[model samples]
Target: MSGTQPTVTLSGGGADDARTVVRALEGTFGAPDERPGDGNATVHTATFAGETDGSAADGGGEGAGRLSAPVTVTVQGSPEAVRRASETLARVFTARDDGAASGDQEQERELHLMP
Candidate 1:
């Protein structure tokens, strides 16, 4: 699950749920290269050119996401990006860290998101 850019892959829920979580991350990581789910796909992925300083959002966005069901999010990137992404998502949604795997330079973390 390593990538050049920090990538967020969302699954285990409706497309809307994926969009919701992705949008939440956007507040911290900026817009992604592609759009999120479109309604038919249960799984969606977005890759972001993460901030240079790796700063996170303060959660001053619009209304909170309305998830139809629980979603599983996998974040893959450098260790800093992965950790920042996990913290940003946890701030927006009810998140439970599933686990993590690491390599020399990249890492991946799985989280369960509920709303």
Candidate 2:
């Protein structure tokens, strides 16, 4: 079996959301049995890839807008466990339109899984 840990990229509406997701992941997969390095699993660094605001033509508001960033969350654990954790994260973070669609303010975030 492969002995390498998987890498997952989560797109968040902002840095705050990214931080929340990272914390959520640690809580989900960093349990005593999984994360021995709290003495068990290693908490890799979390990175934010910056945010971009679309122009008026593309669908941005007059001035400021909701921020978005690419968040990379890394944890060391069994491959099976990591994959399961990532899938669960995807489901939890899926975007939902509350009422911003009409204003052309919908934000799209995607999660990428890497082996």
Candidate 3:
């Protein structure tokens, strides 16, 4: 999927905060979603799923422990857009983890990427 439009799913601990995080990240990218706050309250996520791959291998289907519907963030620029988007989401999770840690919470928030 080289040179193809890349998407980053910005999931969070809840619905409202997920949108906030997306907005924050999108604002950082300077291109917010057309319909912001569209994501619904998942078990605990705001999954922004977008990509050119239309297959089962992408893992975009209903399965156990899967929360919320996918929020497709269309990429229309250079590859750097994808990288920036992914980085924005990554920072959000990191901040969340830091917050939880500050509260003496030991929740695990891991972002595993497999190529």
RMSD of each: 3.2, 16.9, 14.6
* Candidate closest to the true structure, highest TM-score: 1
Q: What do the candidate models score in CA lDDT, each in turn?
A: 0.78, 0.35, 0.35
**Tens-digit per-residue lDDT, 7-49, candidate 3:** 3344434454445444544333333333235456443332233
Sorted on TM-score, best first, the list reads 1, 3, 2
Per-candidate TM-scores read: 0.84, 0.33, 0.35
For model 2, how does the per-residue alpha-carbon lDDT over 50-78 read when each residue is reduced to its tens digit? 11221221221122222244344443334
Model 2 lDDT on a 0 to 1 scale = 0.35
Q: Which stretches of candidate 3 lie over 4 Å from their true place?
A: 1-6, 10-12, 35-78, 95-115
Task: Show model 2 residue runs off by greater than 4 Å.
Answer: 1-13, 31-79, 95-115
Give lDDT for model 1: 0.78
Query: For model 1, how many clashes?
Result: 0
lDDT of 1 by residue, 1-115 (tens): 2333689899988777877877777766777788774668868999987553334366522354778889999999998788878987887778899999999989999999886
- Give the least accurate 10-residue stretch of model 2, judged by summed lDDT: 97-106
Better model by TM-score: candidate 1 vs candidate 2: 1
